[model samples]
Target: MLTINKDKSRREQIESVSIEQLVPHDHLVRKIESAINFDFIYDLVKDKYCLNNGRPSIDPVVLIKITIIQYMFGIKSMRQTIKEIQTNVAYRWFLGFGFSDTIPHFSTFSKNYERRFKGTDLFEQIFNKILQQAIEHGLVNMDAVFMDSTHIKASANKKKYEKVFVEEQTKTYKQALEEEINKDRQKHGLKPLDFTHEKVKLKEIKISTTDPDSGMINKNEKEHQFGYSAHIACDKNGIILSCITTPANVHDSMVFENLFNKTKKNAGKSKRAALDAGYKTPPICKLLMDEGIVPCMPYTRAQHKEGYFKKRQFVYDEYYDCYICPQGQILEYSTTNRKGYKEYKSDPKVCEKCEDLGRCTSSKNHTKIITRHVWEEYMEEVEYLRHTKECKELYKERSKTIERVFADLKEKHGMRVTMLRGIEKVHMQVLLTCTCFNMKKLANWIWKKGKGGPGKGKNLEVLLEFFSKVVLAIIKPHLSFIEKWGFVNNLKRAFARFSIFGVLLTFH
Candidate 1:
């Protein structure tokens, strides 16, 4: 049976409906709004604002929040983000705007970004703030850190490069490193290396005309394209602690110390670090050891050459200060070269009679020469750690930590290609993206632990308890003075504002 229903029209009457009522209670935007504390942005940008301004600027907090929403939702551009916010009820509610309020112009974002936030550390401060919140929730472990870098295609074209030769700047640690090398040589009873006759090596590089700070990088059998490398340091739980941007031509080993210094400052002390083969150089291994960090890294490709004995096969005897070969012959130390390798030479006469000579040496002289760096011991230490059961487990976690972070950033956050031209703008983009990532993680964690999620509400309660305990512990040591001041409750309340406690009180 078919039936038709008649419709009637009625005149519209003025009715009121709250934006909060239109949005669902369990929406992601609601969770993000409730979980993140954006008040800090006001203090971060306070100095940029005039006290008696000609016109009150669009709230800095709202400007930054709009940008965050853009990245979090994968909006293509600022204009699109602004347009979407105009009609989206959830976004309007998050930004505290009424149904008919005007959205800021899209150009306002770029102008504010360039004028108010350019050449500033506001983004980094925001990133650190979110990270600190994660720390308070016990979502990160600072005992071990995993590090890696990835290349992002620059905004410049492949053909828009100019070749130029430039003198390389000497490293600030060169003098200290040379001193350490000389000390190591003396300790090994070998003559120190002389740098008086060393020749300086000049290098040539291609720079992009459009983005001069970007370096040229080659793709698979194609022309070189300008790009930059983004180095990230993350904890064992895959939370990024710090990040750095450099030209693609820069080596991973070159920026390691600089990145680690920032990581230490931001993430506190990490006793163990996991890295890939690109960071397996002797200096890197040595620096990690000097800082009391146990490094976990795989062996270099040179160790796996076919039809030859590996370097480890030549047993080094510390007492005799020599290497024992496969044929029971001692290869005595000769000289430490200018490159800091201690050379060991096997007797050619002894090798001539040995049946393993063909397998040992391809040289016409029929003599075997082995070179080991001055910091070879640190490399060996790292090799030992790589094989340990704990380090083997850490390696398995590495793929989940830093590698997964890179995958999420590239696949979801649009980090594979740069929309900004210069390195500074790229840095700003990365900082905002990373900060949003941490915020999202923190929000999801809070939401999950609140109800029928993994920890079943126990996690949230525990986190709150942890925050309270930390605050109380800091005050308890000076209980007498605190009691004298009569501000114990006020102190607790003030610290609560910085943690999830305040949010818990507001919502729960």
Candidate 2:
């Protein structure tokens, strides 16, 4: 018989509920709370708060927890996060807010950031502190790190940009490159190229008027937009050791040193670093080699005209200080240019009638030229390492580590686009996003180690027993009706077999 209950008892009934009991034992927030001591946040933000004068303020710990909750759950905006906290029991419990307690407004964080945290390293300090905890817990492995960069679309519109000529900032390695160039020139019996009188080059580029700090990104067939690039370095466990944000137009190699240095300082020395083709430049390879770190990078395709002989075909004779072409022609070394490349030129008269001239040289004079940087030897060493078994295996971890980190940041943490404008604000967002990721990873790892709650094996057993009992209870009432169809006997035999197997497994 079909019947409808007219009871509204539960809706009108009053009951006592404890927030702690409301949350599950294996909840992520509970695990995070047990694994991490958020009390340290108080010490970090103490100086920012008025100790003796201001009115009783919202706990800085709560404020930080609110943001953590926002990123941990991939909430889109602070406003929505605050709204969630207002109704979410677990979030409120994690934040130490009672059921009736008021949640902070979304604007509270913005005001605090502008007045107290802006221009301060508070966000970075917090990030480092969380990373330190992970290190202490033995969750970080810095032996072989991976590095890459991802572009985060800025909040500004791409069409709201103006073309302006800006003086290109001199490279930080300019002096080093100059000294190396001069040394190489002296070795080649050539005069050093003077760089003192070099003009400052001004390049015209699009600048977003709304977010002037962001640059126009137009690469990899992606949509042209104003954005910022986050260059990140991570350990083998995907714990981010360092992150630096710059304009989207900034090349990955441009920020390699700063990011690498920060990672070294934070996580101690790394034996090897796996990089992508964008970091296969001479200077980057030289930097890693000078630091005694092996560079593992993929093969970068050389840019050349179709049907022409590749640069690799012209083998350099180190003893003779020249290049030997396929036709056995010697391309003698000429002057070292200011850009740190040694120009090797072939004899035009000798190549004017060669059979392979078409493949070798297309110049009007039939001369072939190749340029090699002073640091090309380091890049060659990297290429040599690329063929080794150790480096090949290390390079394979890039997808599992740094690439996955970026994917999580974009897909799960809402980092694909920024709601902020300035570079500093965007950096803060990156730091917090990364911090939340580390926190979740740390918490989950600790939980799986049998510290958060019941072990996985025990949980599985408990679930099995509970489900088995519930099945018996539901079938018990229907056994008489089921027996008429000759199904109860088979069901009884199946449960008996399952119960015996469970007991045997438990004893085993």
Residue 302, candidate 1: alpha-carbon lDDT: 65
Residue 431 of model 1 has an lDDT of 86
* lDDT string, candidate 2, 121-177, tens digits: 988988899899999989999789999999999999888989999998667688999
> In candidate 2, how many Å is residue 22 off?
0.6
Clashing pairs in 1: none
lDDT of 1 by residue, 221-247 (tens): 655788989999999878899999998
The Cα RMSD in angstroms, rounded to one decimal, for candidate 2 relative to the true structure is 8.5
Model 1 spans > 4 angstroms off = 1-15, 168-173, 187-200, 218-224, 303-306, 349-358, 364-366, 452-508
Q: Candidate 2: which pairs clash?
A: none
Against the true structure, whose lDDT is highest? 2
Error of 2 at 51 (Å): 2.1
